[model samples]
Target: MDHEMTPRPDRLALREWHVDDAAAALSVYSHPEVVRWLIPDMDRVPGVAAMRLLLQQWIAESTRITANGGRWAVYRVADGRVVGGAVLLPLPPGDEDWEIGWQLHPGVWGQGHEEDCAFTLASLAFERGHSEVFAVVRPGNTSSAAVRRNGMHWVGETSKYFGIDLQVFRLRKADFDRTAPEGHQPPTYADI
Candidate 1:
């Protein structure tokens, strides 16, 4: 899956996560309401420095994700805030299905940022030539589960992801075709 990523600027660009993003990321990831929906390991993030190290690691791993697909800081177009994060990476080392995930600050929740970021990234993934994209969500995290309305379909549950009972949602390239044009652009905050 190694390949170059497509550049996006209209909705929100999927740029590499950075050390500077650590504080903003912490603002989103450290919130009890938001982090609860993420993988349990995130519970170990103690403070800003730990979050900075994590973000540094994210920058270190950026090349791999970019080679396979991409991950990003979820750069907001309107005000240029780092709302949260988004990624379309390989399904672990042995699997073929690519995974898409999004995390947005609760302050920005219900503002459509999650949908726009996820949509833009997924569309970029299709452009990068992946046959399918998947999103794994905690059964209780109804917020992330909203990928269903954006063209992903329920594919049952699995504990394979982070050893948790999670609901899986999938969207094939055909699913994209039936749902959106090949070059479709996702909506931005201004467009909302």
Candidate 2:
């Protein structure tokens, strides 16, 4: 197994994607509740084979992060189960700005897991020398908007993806340092 597949002690242990996780991932992605906010044209009920293909693609992209940068699967520390995913994708090559995105299973909704994972990912990005992290959310997604508001400043709208209106929010390294929980020190990529 690759070192990235190894769990980190400090984080909720963002792990590498695995083929075995397809069933669980399908459960999350196929659910109407979860898909409501995702890509509208997404398969409402993705099959296990399709999910496995998606997982394979994710694993491949993550492997390229050393050269291209990307996302990670958010696993729970308590059980090592895959709960969700997070990513820091560059808007344009060689640019310091990146879009940070996260999606948690509906099962963990209302329990603050998203916020915890977001904080961990943001800290990871800043420590990796990223100047800023931004999230684009739909206006009606109150829960996601709340998570964005917690540490990010509203940066207005942009019609870049999803073919729908989006509200952009950003968090600079400086603002993240001031707003993150007390004693929340940032973690270098080596720390992961």
Candidate 3:
């Protein structure tokens, strides 16, 4: 990931996360409805201090280009609201696994945002010289299953990543390109 980035399709943009996003992050992430099915601990909500510390971590991650990848804040083109966040980060060392994940506000749930954000970020990864994009979904999270439905194939169940057992899904650039309309490509950080 570039230190400065804004990557997306026409309707969505993935911007670098900023301190200003703290309230928005808390608003969405701390709410039970958003994290319940997505995170390992559905009951886990980062407190204000914890969230701020996390924001700092996100800032650091955004600057690095690694298998662990980085997180980008998702913005709606029509209104510029920070609706959610997406990440294309690395798995554990030597596995060379790149993971894609999303955390969206429940207010905007079921509107295809996760699919759009994940697809764009995965495309960004491919465009950036990465081999494959993966997503780890907890077994019962049919909400997160939408990304798998978008085009990712189920690899299997595993606890190898983050030490959390999850249903793994994957999408390769070859497959992404084949499924995309002709001439389709994910936008670059410079595109914004």
Candidate 4:
């Protein structure tokens, strides 16, 4: 578990958010293009101060996150730059189904960051014993292609999770296993 939690010096890494990441996080959250595709409830991060405050809140709330889930800051291994955020958590209302999501800086868009985040988190979820994981994208959002690239199947739309219509895609453990590289294991959240 200790080894699993340690940040990998690979193409990308996932670890818990840090206060100093506000500026990098802002790069992802404050952009109009990124914000426009996010869930309706989330607004543009506004500024670095606001991004810092949000990171603080997310860090505090992270402690209460379930053992199999967490909120993480995505980093580019080559430059150690914060490129985005990733999360794998149970959906709201019933909290029975898990959801996998990521937000990347516009500069890194279409560079496999989204797919890496999705596959890593989905692998972690499956390794943690979940049978399936879902991704919900707002209609007309072009990011759905990344989800499909990760092998998730379109499962139709439903407003149940976020109180707004979204295109739901699902990836079963068996399906994910078929595409996952042999012996591939994502960084874990043991420290969190």
Candidate 5:
């Protein structure tokens, strides 16, 4: 029952955030193309101070989430480079389900990296005892919708903090198990 068995170290890698990753992180966040679908106002050029603050928050959140068993930094196996990040944020006070979200650099888009990362995260979620995982895609984000459709079912719609409409997709453990390709394996800690 060790969750470790679910993530293989030989294929994809999932690691923790590092201060040295600040530049790469900022590059991804500050890219207009990358932030277009995200709800945050990362479209503008954030000042040095703002960037530092954001990195600091990501670092802190990474630590906290690791302790809670719900965060990951995705890296490519071909090269030991961080490609994206994802997390399973716990539900709020009255909510009963965890939310799964991910973001990859624009350079890696259309290469199936996002789908791989999503599948890895989803597998990790199920391994850690989650009954289901949900992804909220902003309306009109076809790429994200496609990623969601790769292994999840179209559930319905919901509203975000700013009242932006979001299309909700979900994947239960059974669904993921049945849909995952044969010979598929999740990433391991050493692979990071």
Candidate 6:
């Protein structure tokens, strides 16, 4: 988690969120569409000042997480635009299962940034010696498509995580190796 994160040049880049990124992050987290999907654990970030405080907390918390887990800001490598964020962390309560999650601004939705972000974080978990990673989504959330495309298999609904009903998807390290080989990048829109 503390190591420098650099995804493929052709794909998205993952880095620790900085306080200066608050404005760009606001563009993603404050959107009504994005917030509706987030629901309970997160709400629409009201302003740049509030978002900066939140980022500060995240930065401080990352230091206490000794596991290979942390939150990252997702960026488009081509233009260096902040699309959203990605996270690799332990599922709460049990803290045994690894979870991978991502969020992208509505402005960049359906352009494959979701899949790239999800895959990038999950791959990082695997490389850090985790055997598998999970993704839990709100029942009706459309992000499931990106999760599936990233090679995560549906594992059915469960309220075990976050004490809320949600659909869960999982991916193993072996499954990832088959889906995206070394040096292989996720498909672009044209490639799809």
Displacement of residue 87 (Cα, Å) in model 6 is: 0.3
Show model 6 residue runs off by greater than 4 Å: 1-10, 181-192
Please write out the lDDT profile of model 2 over residues 1-192, one tens digit for every residue.
Answer: 111212234335565678898887777778877667763346654699998888888888777666335667777676767777677677543544577777778887776566666676677677677777877777787778545645788888876655677787888888786666544454446634
lDDT per model, in order?
Answer: 0.69, 0.67, 0.71, 0.80, 0.64, 0.77
- Candidate 6, residues 52-158, lDDT tens digits: the string is 99899978877677558887888777777787887787888778998888878888787666766676677678767799999989988865688888788999999
* Residue 97 Cα positional deviation in candidate 4, in Å, after optimal superposition: 1.1
Measured by TM-score, the strongest candidate is 4
Model with the higher TM-score, candidate 5 or 6: 6
Top candidate on lDDT is: 4
User: Candidate 6: minimum summed lDDT over ten consecutive residues — where?
Assistant: 183-192
Candidate 2 — worst ten consecutive residues by lDDT sum?
Answer: 1-10
lDDT of 4 at 24: 92
Writing each residue's lDDT as its tens digit, candidate 4 over 158-184 gives 999879999999999988866553345
Given candidate 3, what's the lDDT at residue 68? 37
Q: What's each prediction's TM-score? A: 0.82, 0.81, 0.82, 0.88, 0.79, 0.87
Indicate the residue-level lDDT of 46 in model 1. Answer: 71
Q: Please identify model 5 stretches exceeding 4 Å from their true place.
A: 1-12, 40-49, 66-69, 91-95, 160-162, 188-192
Q: How high is the lDDT of residue 47 in model 5?
A: 53
Candidate 1 lDDT tens digits, 1-192: 211112334344455677877888888888888778775346836789999988888767667554556567776665667777877777753657788887877887875556655566667777677888988888788687458767889899988776778898888878775554245543322110
Model 4's alpha-carbon lDDT is 0.80
